[model samples]
Target: MRKKLFRATVLMVVPFFASLLIRLLYVTNKKVFHAPKSVGSEPIIFACWHGELLMLPYLYFQYRKTPNAKVLISSHFDGLLISKTIEYFGLETIAGSTNRNAAKVLIQGIRALKDGYDIGITPDGPKGPRHEVADGIVIMAKKTKAKIALFNVKPTKFWQLNSWDKFIIPKPFGTLHYYSTSEIDVSEMDIEEAKLLIKEGLLKHEA
Candidate 1:
């Protein structure tokens, strides 16, 4: 009974705060937050830390000039929330992660890139050494001939979640900051180079 009550309490609170974040932080003229650039006519893999997931849907709804997009998420229950939120904004999800059929899920993401869809991935995710970059994104971009765009979200009002990923939850009615580094054209760089650059860029953004 206690667990059921706890779960019920969580479900109600999570969505309420999520909606609060949208009301406070999802805004226009994101240009000041990120530099604009053409990501080539080919598809892109938008890589951001797990903490940035809160603003991701809004970023998609606001900045997507493309017709297709899908985010690669894990099979965890949180993935269900992420999936539902993205789909709620007319996006799709390709579920798979380091724990289950990771390769297949990655291939699906690459396929989405090939078929003309932008993809978002959290390099440090599904449980993480928070904010570290993983090589999987580099490998996938290299194989798919896609560019990578790195994003970071700085909250104006939020608490640091105790989850392994240090999931960030923003309180209602506060500004949020965003940083989008330049695209890394994987075709021009090796996997190691891509990973290094992406990692450096994200770290630099945090600093």
Candidate 2:
């Protein structure tokens, strides 16, 4: 009973603090958008590397006003923290990952696309051999024929975490150079071809 109560308190309190921190960092950062206007349309997949996931809620909100986005997060406890934190930004969460209950993840993603929700996916997330792209995102795009908005960020100042994805937190008052592909259609390509194409697009802005 004590453990359950502690977990509940963390869940309730941490996301509010985390979201506050993100908002603080975001408002202090000078962001440059190098993305096409068509990137955040409905039914699109917003793909980015796991390390660059920090400031993306701000990125999404900058372009999209409907607040109809859902992010693919792992079913782990850490993912739960993220799920709750992003909810503060008016984004929904889908809990599952490529390595665990992958079928459910794919199905739910396709369903969300059909319903016109743009999905935020960190292709190598929930765990990572950092910067590596996984195949699940490619499969989801092909299966649903959803266009992908692949993006990257170059921050002039930031702190990098020691986690597997080398998660970053952009320092206050710094500039963020943001770049994104207009749209990528993987419906006609073979799985491997599509996967490699996306992998390249995502890594383009990485140092």
Candidate 3:
């Protein structure tokens, strides 16, 4: 009973506060996008590092705004909060992790793609070795014949958490830059090559 109540309260309160914070910070902050509008329009797989997830949902809402998008999330306690938060912004969640139920999640992602729902994934997530690229994302793209778009969010001023990903929280008013690479065609490349390409695209602007 206690666990259920706690979960219910978190679901209700977290989304409201998360959405409010995202909107407030976004409006007050200046934003820069590296790619053109067309890149944002494509329904390809959106890939980013786990550390940069703090402002990603808001960034997607601001730029992509795909109502049918579904994000890959782990089936952990933290994932529960994040799933609820992103759902508030109209993005669905697939609860599973790379280390567990990976095949199931990949299948779900493929199906979502086939159904024309945009897919978002953090390749190095749900307990990460930092920004290392996992092959699951590449394989999903290969199976679905969907292109991959690598992105990174950098804030001029922010707080970095002590977590594995070193999660970031942008200061109330700061410059946020969203960088993305051109859609990567995975048809020709094998999984390993695709992984390398995505890693490069995501880390290209990192100093």
* Among all candidates shown, the one with the greatest lDDT: 2
Q: Estimate each model's TM-score.
A: 0.82, 0.95, 0.94
Candidate 2: stretches off by over 4 Å: none
State residue 195's C-alpha deviation in candidate 3, in Å. 1.0
Q: Which run of 10 residues does model 3 get worst, by summed lDDT?
A: 57-66
- Candidate 3 clashes between residue pairs 3 or more apart in a chain or in different chains: none
- How much does candidate 3 score in TM-score? 0.94
Q: What is the C-alpha lDDT of each candidate?
A: 0.72, 0.85, 0.84
Cα misplacement distance, residue 111 of candidate 2 (Å): 0.7
lDDT of 1 by residue, 93-174 (tens): 8887744687798788878888888988898876777877777788788888787887777767778877887777765556
Clashes by residue pair, model 1:
none
Stretches off by above 4 angstroms in model 3 are 40-42, 61-66
Per-residue lDDT of candidate 2, residues 74-108 (tens digit)? 88888899999999999998999877898999899
Q: Considering only N, C-alpha and C atoms within 3 Å, which residue pairs clash in candidate 2?
A: none
Candidate with maximal TM-score: 2
Instruction: Quote the positional error of residue 12 for candidate 2 in Å.
Output: 0.8
Error of 2 at 119 (Å): 1.2
